[model samples]
Target: MNAVKTGSHAASTLEKTPVGDLVDGKGHSSGAEWLTRYSTSLMGVFGTPQRVLVRGAGCLVWDADGKEYLDLLGGIAVNALGHAHPFVTSVISSQLATLGHVSNFFTSPTQIALAEKLLALTHAPPGSKVFFANSGTEAVEAAFKLARRNGASPDGTTGKRTKIIALEGAFHGRTMGALALTAKEAYRAPFEPLPGGVVHIPFGDVAALEAAIDETVAAVFLEPIQGEAGVRPLPPGYLKAAREATTKAGALLILDEVQTGIGRTGKWLATEDAGIVPDAITLAKGLGGGFPIGALLTFGEQTSSLLAAGQHGTTFGGNPVATAAALATLHAIESQRVLENVAVVGDYLRTGLAAVDGVTEVRGEGLLIGFDLDAEVAPAVVTAGLDAGFIVNSPGPRTIRLAPPLVLTKDQTGTFLAALPAILRTAKDAQ
Candidate 1:
């Protein structure tokens, strides 16, 4: 009841202000005002804004009005250990105070340590190297370029081996190279002539993949669990078949682990669940806890000596503060046994979701869960959940996605599950 009461205050503040007014106005100092300013100057890539959160701790965030919400979306599966964890904050602060950033030509211990840890955890072979970037899109772009560099045909030029095989309903990123790999027409139509030489195959279809990938294909790119496509899991043996096929064709295998890596999937990497070791793995999202950082890991002979000294670089890609934040995040996940928590809480949420009415199916692993609605009422369900003081998402017309913080407790989940049936009823009534 207290949460319910507090939630109203948050929502009221959001509703009272016109998003456009805040974007154009000045001298306003509220979160709503900040959001308005954000909308005006920021590109309209993500559509309209929601509640402007002012602060967060653990799995909870408070909107501008100070109404608390159980963060079930978890910043789209990026808050692996939850928001504002002391370890992450302290490391970031200390690192910033010591040395904030340095160019790529120079190296820092934090960046080197984080890269080494990632490579070690992934079981990459000796000499496997990492190239840091600023975001998931950039990481994927780096992977794409790396895939191409090591994929030249016998002609010694990238003529025959030019195509990349991506999955239908797959979301790589929005940058040019990564966007070419993404299958969503809505995100790609406006920006056509995208980096060419890419093909799309239906996800979870081994035969289709076999048909599409061949000698000319340079690499096979896949998300072990398709997070943006309603958290669909790869069918058993699909990844194995892909690996074998790519190997047979001499095409590399790239796993886009941006959303499922770093313990979001109950494992260090989702590909581990499939027993496949990809040539290159693109990672971001939860890697930095809440800090901005992305990485590309290449192993064995596939770790081509591409990207000459000045080929690709980012000013803030491996900033000491973000790297420190990531190192702390990795340590906390292992020391605090956060992956175990993800498994326990994730299963509980999945079990509760299965018992809910109007849910046609439940899928995904770890804290990333998705349920299909019996009808096209997921939006209504999301709205009802919001009114009930819980933050959730409708990833599709008939699917609800819950990527709750790993720190979310069983009691918090119970609170949401207890309110779910009424939320469903409310959604139906609204429909």
Candidate 2:
């Protein structure tokens, strides 16, 4: 075992031992060997592991083979301040040392502070409240419950307002309740008889949204930018329209900001871009800067009062360490002006990608970007990117998504831009 100091923090010691070497009393030196062990030990839901990443710092990660790649995906937009951000690391360590886990029967200062902070950041109205969860899916689950609770008659009944509306290309989460709201058939097909009454409408179609959302609807769910749907943003005025329709139809408007919130789009909430306040918003991903925390913010007294005591709860949600990490992540984002950096670097990448010969279109806001290729070679492009010391993702046959760290700089993006033409050429050749 070896001790390595990262960045300017010498007190922190990172173990340099290979993780594979410690498993099963056998030393597995390479990524392929560890992956072979992984197949037998882990479930196959996510397919093969892309790479056995050993360590990461800032916007870069090293694979088991010691190859370095610029991380453009940022752990699917979870690593907002980038991997191993020193401030977040220090806060977590300190919190763990002082007070780690406490059952939900009790609460800590950090938990209260985080809830207050989220409310303040979202500019939530008075009586707004926050419910902490362990991940984005859990937060969505809570929001689903909020919708159901809102639909209950004054005397408590179920079937009154049961229908929920979601868009054509939304990816809410994989949980049964969230899965019901998700628009993809492949994900929902396996788990049929899903909490019924979820209908999928065309993405960003105002008329369809207006028509689908009526008195019978309990809630209307939307993503400001449909990230898994090739980074497609809703048409302008779409969120405002949804808000209006839901309000008029007496339905709750819930925005899933799991991938787009917490400064991923240069704003605390992507809903801010549209200047409309929703009944509730689900957050995760960048909230704890990779420390695994999610939250559901319910706006106003009416919406916040829907879920009463004992209606929903979690065992490990809002623990001190997670909330402390979230506070540190928020502090770093503000003090370092990471949102401004996101705007500058995001524009640079979008413009450069559009100029590339093989790219047909580039879409997204801030650091959550996507582009289309001239051909259906997105998967090939992902492979070529990994091989060329860069990380990227393809959500569809012709679409590639890049949700780089909010702290990514223009210089780092220039490197990817310089390598992209060649990477695209290689992908096209492979296709």
User: For all candidates, what are the clash counts?
Assistant: 1, 0
Q: Judged by lDDT against the true structure, how good is candidate 2?
A: 0.92
Best by the TM-score measure:
2
State every prediction's TM-score relative to the real structure.
Answer: 0.91, 0.95
Each candidate: RMSD: 7.8, 3.9
Itemize residue pairs with steric clashes in candidate 2.
none
Quantify all predictions' global Cα lDDT against the true fold. 0.86, 0.92
| Pairs that collide, model 1 | 23-36
C-alpha lDDT of residue 100 in model 2: 99
lDDT of 1 at 259: 90
